[model samples]
Target: MLHSKSILSFVLVLFISGCSSVVLPIDERALINDIKAKYQGEILAPEDLKKGDITTYSFPPVWGFNVRSYFSRDGSFSLDREFYRFKNEDRGSTIFEHFIESEGDIEKTGRQIILKNRIAYRKYDSSSDLNYLSTFKECEFKLGTCTYKSASGKDKKVKTYFENGVWTSEYEGFRNSKLIETKIYHKSGLLIFSSYKGLIRGNTSYSNREAFEANSL
Candidate 1:
C-alpha cells in the first residue's frame, strides 16, 4: 500500500508539471509577413530582428522622417509615422517641427485596421518640450497632396496645405493663443529646406528658415 501511494503521488506531480509547462504557440514570421502584405510596401527590418520573437521595422529615408512598426509577443502591433524639419542647420539636422502622420494599433481580425484614437500634432520652437502649437484629431490620413480628416467635433478641421512645391502645416492653440506654422520643401522624399513661424506673448513673432544646399560644404 505504501509503494502504491508513492507511485500515485509521483504521477500526480507529473500531471501538474505538464499542465504548468504548456506554452501557447507563436509564429513571429507569420505575423511579420501578414503586416508586410497588408501595407504593400517594403518594410526595412529593424537591426534587432530575430526569430520567434518581437521585432520592429524602421523604414527610410531614415533622415528627417521616421516610420516605426512594432510587433508584440501577444500578436498585437502598432505603427507610428512621424516627420520632422531641421532646426539647427548650422550644426547639421535638428528637429524644428514634428508632425505625427499616423499612430495606432494594427489589429488582425479577418482584416487589419488602425484603431481610431486621439492623436495630436505638435510644433516646437527649439529642441525643448515647449510646444508652441498643437492640433487634435481622432483620425488623419495623407493621400498625395490631400489629407482626409475623419476626426469629429471641434477638432475635425483639416489644417495642412500643399501648394506649388511645398507642404505647409499650421497650429494655433498653445500658450496664450499663440500661432505656429511650418513649411517643408522636399525632393524625392528628402528634405531640402524648412521654415517656421510662431507668435510670442507680447504680440510679436519669431521665425527661422534652414536651407540645405546641394553643393554647399
Candidate 2:
C-alpha cells in the first residue's frame, strides 16, 4: 500500500506539472535498484531504450532532465536536443526562445553544450539562483560541512556549503530533516534572503556546476 502510494504520487507530479522534472541518475543500475526496492518497478536498460520506447535519457556528460538519446535496436543512439525556455510569463507559452544544444557526443572537451545554455538563460531570462554571480564575491562555496553560529548565541550543525569565509549564509537553526530553511546572501554578504526548501531537491547540481567549479580555481 505504501509502495503504491509512492508510485501514485510520482505519477501525480508528472500529471500536474505536465512535464518531467525528474533528474536521471548517472548510475542507471542504482536507479533500477531503487525502483525495485521503493516501488517495485523497472526502467529500460541503457541500450534497450529505443525511440518511442523512451522519452527520458541521461547519459554521462549529457545527463540531466534534458531529453536525450533515441536508442535503436542495433544498440546505437542518436543526438537531437532542443531545449527551450519560457517566454512572456505565460504557461504553455509558445513564445519560446531557442537555446543551445549539444554539438557532438558527450565526451568532447571543447563542447559548449552546458556553458551556452547557461549564457542563454542568463541573458534572455534571469538566472533563478544567480549562482554564477558568486564568483565576484570575497569568498565562494564548495561542498563541505560547517557549523553555523546564530545571533541567538546558539550553534547549529549543518552540512552548509560555506559561508566560504562569509558570515550571513549560515543556517540559523538547522535541524536534520528532509527540508532545510536556506539563507541566501548578496556578493558582499550584506543582503539576506531566506526561503524554505526541500534539501534533497535543492541539492541538485546544475549541468555545468562541475565545470564551473573546476574553472573557479
Each candidate's root-mean-square deviation in Å?
Answer: 25.0, 19.7
TM-score of each: 0.27, 0.19
Q: List the residue pairs that clash in candidate 1.
A: none
Residue 18 lDDT (model 2): 13
Q: Give me the displacement of residue 52 in model 2, in angstroms.
A: 42
Candidate 2 wrongly placed segments (more than 4 Å): 1-29, 32-121, 125-141, 145-217
Give the per-residue lDDT digits (tens) of candidate 1, residues 51-92: 324222221322322222222234332323333433232222
Shift in Å, residue 135, candidate 2: 14
Top candidate (TM-score)? 1
What tens-digit string does per-residue lDDT give for candidate 2 at 131-187? 222211212232345544444545644444423222222232223323333332222
Clashes of 1: 0
